[model samples]
Target chain A: MELVGISKLNADYEAAMAVRKGIKLFIDESAKENFKKAGIEVAGTKVEMISDSQIVIDATPDGIGAKNKALYVSMKKPAIFQGGEDADVAEASFSALCNYDEAKGKNYVRVVSCNTTGMLRVICTLKNSFKVRKIRAVLIRRAADPREVKKGPINSILLNPVELPSHHAVDIKTVLKDLDILTMAYVVPTTLMHVHALTVQVDGNPSKEEIINALESSRRILGISKDSKIASTAEIVETFRDMGRIRYDVPEVVFFEDSIHSSNGEIFLTYAVHQESIVVPENIDAVRAMSGLKEKEESISLTDSTLGLLRGRLV
Target chain B: MELVGISKLNADYEAAMAVRKGIKLFIDESAKENFKKAGIEVAGTKVEMISDSQIVIDATPDGIGAKNKALYVSMKKPAIFQGGEDADVAEASFSALCNYDEAKGKNYVRVVSCNTTGMLRVICTLKNSFKVRKIRAVLIRRAADPREVKKGPINSILLNPVELPSHHAVDIKTVLKDLDILTMAYVVPTTLMHVHALTVQVDGNPSKEEIINALESSRRILGISKDSKIASTAEIVETFRDMGRIRYDVPEVVFFEDSIHSSNGEIFLTYAVHQESIVVPENIDAVRAMSGLKEKEESISLTDSTLGLLRGRLV
Candidate 1:
């Protein structure tokens, strides 16, 4: 909830106020109340300077390697790094996953790779389990702005850009390398949430009910049930005018009414996940799990219904 | 090259001028062409006339047994019986396929259902040969025509009177079943061709090349190939002078392209094949294939150097 950094957004005062809510002011002297200068430490790092920030999520653009490495090394504690298109990163730079247990005692940790984090949280739950068999995903994405390159029905992305999707599959491949996984990703024209079309071939002829129940057990997946619900802003997304950056709940198993065939005995289950929120659930929980404040369960329940709660393995 | 039929469609009216160079015609006032009224002399327990020109394709459209049995009796020599919705057609109705070899002296042969036909063709192709573990096909189609109550893409059909693209998958499916064929069918906007999206899981890792090749070989499959040739001309169709109703050379294939991913992967081969042409290729071959035949081939060969004959398939 505490927003920080990128003190100067090179934006107008009105634009800055419109984008922020709390109006916190811990940014560099040049930064206004809304934005902050990312003070990344280490002399040669991409960030201008590093401060004693508790949680440093390096949201850097693609294609930066050595600079980010220096930032991570400069950290007193492990830090979370996000390199959007550069998800195919080196593992040695970040892997607090195993140490989260010990680090939690110290109240700290670092993360790397958004794709790896998001896919891992969702896919890990599917791995170490037999209920999952195959995976197919398609992302309905929009450019950040419309003046951008043309994307399939995108909301807005300004530059003429080559929208991408499959690149994440490779990043995910490396993240889940220890576990057997396979993924197929596609990009659509949308802004934030990446909607995914998923298919899971269970070990046997498991009834639809069983599949639903398995999905309900994963903390990363949301299966429809009495207690389940799409995160609220969605309940109010229509209310906010100019709320162009809003997103739907991730792992929301939407029924593609267009692709269902009861006569043929087959169906393709689909979902959408916000890139920003993808790590929120796991990041909060990782601190707890590493600190021994939580018990190791077989799976985490993220949905309301029990129908196929496992975020099905990448394959 | 000869152009002989009940109608000398491609020739000039030289007959009236007493010329010998024109094609021949076999004219008769009463003859059966539509499958149902075709003359079938074979008599069996299933022999019974259900309607004047229309034979009950199934035992019953709404209720009981193999109504198509009536087709076995009404056909002139051999005719096709069909089942729409959930009608149960007798396997015996597909006898035409099984006994085609014996047709040296026999009269009729029956066959399987349309969905079954599409299913078999896809599963038996080069991609699977028993190497595939499962296959799922989603067939989104339109109603055949308006004379019947169409149950699909409901709102669109109600407002506009357009061509439909349903039932195209039946033939494709019938030709490739047994590979865990699960199909989903839809009734879309036009009365043209059926659209389908298929995913097949084989023994090995899925490959794009193999999938493309498998689809290319499916005679009923359209809209695929390295050339993005739009292998069929369904899209370019319009009201033309000579042809009464325009269609694709491979309607099933063309329809399939509409069902699968578009924009990405791109359509390499696509085009329309006149429906009448499917039934009259031989006659057209005599006229056009051999067009300006002998002399043209000689001149083309001399100028083409070699391998020019291969261009026929391209044209």
Candidate 2:
């Protein structure tokens, strides 16, 4: 499959291509001359870029995706929307592990938010092996992304909704229809990652080893042991940087192996979710499902392998 | 009661008195000359300060309290220890609201830690009006005191104990002997306050107003309404500073009035504990309890009045 970028802004298009593989093409001599004068080569955009592409990934800012959906629908093109878009903006809220089949051949698929995506991977992975009952999660959320200067709590922990079961849990229920889950969230001063303290109850009593094995087997979950010395999100990002991960992006859900504790059919564990990149792989899989190009496992494996995720201890 | 500062270091003595009300007295000419040359009339410590004092407040560092126990015991002085000391170091681990009776007339009374003190005030207050069966609290802790530059996760949310029921719960249990409570803690990048998300199971189905009334009636717990516009820890400190509070200290537990929700014998609420000063009132009460100067209610009322706590909406 070929990839192309389209944005009203030339800089946005350039940024899109820089993160992926694409040839820098100049649309006009003026555009080329502008870059030459600045002593830098640049990429350019075309008016018919959307028309030329088979599918569109509406990666625009939040409400913008809903607006762009009209254009995509008018063109009769299948589009995948980011988590920012509301559920009504898409035919279905997508999670590759939870409901990839629901997105197959659909015109619009909205991959749930980063936290929702991270949770789906773990919950769905567990559901695949056990009769899951209920879950209570306390989300210690990052106040802002590292690049975000305007957004803040700066040195405060704010209750995101100041209420019970933040939107992420409700969002999860959008896909996993009957799952019993409740989430409480607090936004803390950190841009690295969001940490979740989860307590799950299942039908059968499972050993800690069995639970760990089930989670570890998932290509999208990276089980980190205590001995790794990659204790906090800072060390996780530092390890990713040391390992030469692009943008220090850890697309996989980081599960602390030592944090797993199971007793009397109840399991307790904690994991860190990279809010920026946890949904990237899900978006890739969503693209495949929307295009009807591959089966669920096939798409997930392809995306994981392409992104070099779950390649053992990241440290 | 007369207060005397007794620290081997004059600087430590000065800092202690600066926060409290005491006249600066120089013990030696050299010390007086040194302060005069520095353009400051500083308080000096006498070698006989401990012997001359009726009671001692051991504010030394953690294990140092245990070591200092030997000296206090040798001096035959009734002393009240800070939370830093172990339970074994004192005759009782005390929270004014929880175990003031047990601490009464005791020579060595250890005021529980800041977090424990915060929990005890709320729990004991609730236990006063209702039979609390169980409690599960998620403690979002401040990484360090604002004045401490040496301590940090800086930009990370660390699981204080990468396990369930962090030390705070265990510490709380030390005082509330048979109270069933489970606590989880994450240390975030904030030095202002520790936010607690508490879900308490009670024997009776109390109305939200009843619960709020019980909590507010406690002089040590300050109920903050949403209308006050004090949303997070930063705003709480700012409001205190605006109120001309000494050192911007909020010695009361700041409970969010709007965060309280009651359903089917369960109470869910969130409150902020100013880690620096939440225990100040408790410490004052502890001194009175240890010295047998006042009974439980009398000591608490006196301390609350002296600290100017629970006056009204701080904002």
Candidate 3:
């Protein structure tokens, strides 16, 4: 694994820096001096890194992945793109819960954005248990990462399009082609977590216990504190800190057991996705799926266990 | 406006103490000394408080309200009861959003609880804008009020029935006779707020803007900050603090403008009801309704304005 960047991050990059091994920085000449000064080793250029690696995860700034497609094509190696990249850069959008098969035997897979992944994790978990008639999701997104201090309208709330369905519904359709989804997206000032409030209308009446059981069955969904002790995302981050997570990152979807409500056939609930680590597991699973080294179930299970997804309470 | 209580509270009672006028404590001999020592004047027995007032608002504990009905009955004064009282104790349950008119000329009115009020606010707001076919709500309730440290399983999540459709649906029907609602209740350890996640299946495909406009039309609904600055409820409380609210209480339902998502007649979103202040506005409206001094519109408007409910962001 290699950490490839075009230049030195405007500020310290904690998420990338937290990786202690199997990571060599492939940065430009301008960033090389800063890397060495910071007591970090630097690898060759982006072109050399692409050729040397078995798999490339293009996590560069938005639109940059599409620009670097030629290098990956030259190597004929499997590459994964982050949400910031357009779907055109890859054959199909990837969500571990939505379309694992799409990633198999593929050279390019674009992992869906953080918000979309959270919605997929939830909708996919319950879709099999109940007949989903419709889905409406509200994405309360973080305006900027904690480190990106200069990036936002810190006081005002901006609604994208001031309309019904935002790009999220369109992005979700890239994988869940048949499902009907309407997404409303808003970027808030908070840099902590992105919260998705979802309502899925399913056919027939499902019991609350039934809905809880269905979600609990999913290994990827980690049930966080339902007890009020950890009420807000700030407290939730603190819980992760107290749990002694290496980078204080919760890669899995965190939901409240008490928040699960099923009435008649409709389900309503709220869940938080850590913008920093939600895609990390999907990236690992995509590697296995793209390499064709293991089956979907084995790959997902291996990713979940290795990532400590099962450490939290189930319900 | 009367602060008639059985005794001096063991802990600080911010809500009650915040009232500037028209409060009299009615406590027994045991706690009467504490009230006088705290420089508070004491009224006579429960019977005197019920008899002397033009209208009585019974803030007594559960079962105790039923027991004290004899006192209110003797005076024939219209009394408002909290949710803790049984249905038999009151003629009908009261929510400002639901059955406000029913409170008129009623001898006994029961104001719904905090969690119920939050759901009712959202449901009533939407029901008017769209034909609601079905509703499912999950109540992430506060285990105990901030003042009631003695009353809770503070570290554990408790499912009241360990099944579907807890008492909230049954209670909702007591006010809304035709609503098809199912509510699941769970108590979390946090004392800050009770969060309600609601999903409604409506008759037509409504746009997100239409749904948001409906809620914003209601003065009691306060759209809070969505940007990174005020991410958590802790910060929301601080926002109220900076605004110089009397009790640091948010009497209105705090939701996000970006959280309104509607597609194919289904709407989804999450909002937090400050457990300390949610019922306060309802209680105020209930008094006006019970006393028959004003119509429903005037009563609700007067309550909202007097409580500064219109001060927060509308959208």
Candidate 4:
């Protein structure tokens, strides 16, 4: 994601030529030329034809761009729209997997930030449940912006990411119909995980255990587990290193919190995402959805295919 | 807490003169000013002169602030250093039967943030049974400097809060010395709950359920319950208001991170606390030390009355 995020597609000859040979995610013409020289299977029409399987991730600077139209037309079989930054994910939006049904033809669904997806899964799980009186999500992001990384000051850092909380709140509502709900997002410069310290004050006084159990029982696609708490920063780093040694086939994306401290006693615990492997989620999830796996079947799919295939190739 | 945070006893005013009128809690003073002209007493040395059954809160700032050193001996009982910001909780920290015990005999101890207390409890519980490996805490702060209240960049807003992973972790170890571990902490500028999305990769791969139960079974200081994966921002606000309606006692110190996103397929949970209400555990293990009230009737020495009082208070 940051590969394309750092800069726009360069149209120059070198960048185009280096496209194919250098890497595969997003290759420009110059880079493509480089790939052609390297003799990689530079398939597809060179005329920049956005064909089927040609997903146009709506990272076009616009928070919400006109990529849905592109998907409606180009998705001859099963196309996708990776809604990166500010793209809205409404209940009616294909991105809302709970409402997602069998597509008559090719379909276009958006995958917003890792933070939004995480928030959505949690909210939607309890949306219809009358237990909750209200819900709020703070999309705490990483310090390094893939598209463009620029350091900002702190006070402004805590500022809500959404220009208008109402619409975005609805965006959360479309998926999570809890009438009494709101969404607040902030971008912090820590890249271990996108910490979303949500506060849920239910209509009735429910036991904390009951609420936590409800969350733990949620789907794996949401990738949440009771095991992940606001981990200590040292533990977070240790977990990151542990993943490599344990060599888990699954791209075990460990979750931890920005759960840190202050002498002032202000509690700020946001989630963390390993900036290096952030895209690991998108790939695994995309493959799972593309492979036609059900909500819970994704794990099996990964075991039988996704992780297996990757491991096999590595060996 | 902000009152103590901002201003200090001016040197211009005679030291005894400042005491003659009586010590007043920040909020008490504010109330006297706002509601009526009856200026109230803050940290008055009522140990020897108590006409009313008033609450004598140990809202003193940090450790050093609590100790009555010879340098400040002229003052009856050294003024308990407290960030007057806690004037918000002045009513509760002192008023209610909140069983909080602080070392009052010329020593220092911390009344931590709720998250700080919760994290300390969580880690200590884990360390008691499991072979500890590492600990880390990433804290997102409100405003590093209380002065800057406006929206600002994430960088400037972040602070490495002191007394986290350390004061709590070490304090726990001081009593429960079963394992060796390392810790780290970072602070960001988001307020409310110090949402901690933690992950404990034990010495071996413990079943997820085992880990959850181990956590839930921990000490009673912090409530460790399960939660849903997604909680919109609205839920958070409503929860706050709801907590207000319930009139949660102890100033309802913590915020719940009902939605700490794990991943496309992960798990996360979190909790928060009002740092001050937390009792610094007796060196670490207060239960074993507080056995005086136990049915066994263990004859425990009452060397540290603060610890004894706390031990006596432990339920």
Top of the candidates by TM-score: 2
* Alpha-carbon TM-score of each model against the true structure: 0.48, 0.91, 0.69, 0.44
Worst 10 residues of 2 chain A by lDDT: A6-15
Docking class for candidate 3 = incorrect
Question: What would the TM-score be for candidate 1 when compared with the true structure?
Answer: 0.48
**Candidate 2, overall lDDT?**
0.80
Q: Assess the local accuracy of residue A242 in candidate 2 as a C-alpha lDDT between 0 and 100.
A: 88
lDDT (CA) per prediction:
0.34, 0.80, 0.71, 0.37
Q: Model 2, B138-257: lDDT tens per residue?
A: 888999998888999889988777757687888898888898787878889988899998888898799988988898777778877777776688888888888898889888888877
Off by over 4 Å in 1: A6-20, A25-52, A64-78, A83-123, A126-150, A153-169, A188-210, A225-276, A283-315, B1-121, B127-133, B137-179, B183-315
For each candidate, give the interface RMSD after superposing the true interface residues on Cα. Answer: 13.5, 1.5, 9.1, 9.6
lDDT of 3 by residue, B1-315 (tens): 554443334313542463235555565556656655666666665556655677777777778878778877877777788887777788889888877898888888898877777778878888787889887665656666767859754433344433357788887877788988877665544566666656688998988667767777876787654453443455566678887987688888877655556666767666778877888889888888877778888888888777778634632
Write down the lDDT that model 3 would get. Answer: 0.71
User: All models, DockQ values?
Assistant: 0.04, 0.61, 0.07, 0.05
The top-ranked prediction according to lDDT is 2
- Per-residue CA lDDT of candidate 1, range B214-296, in tens? 55543443333323333112332322212333322232323222223322222111122222222221211122221233332
What's the CA error at residue B299 for candidate 4, in Å? 52
> What is the Cα-based TM-score of model 2?
0.91
lDDT of 1 at B149: 46
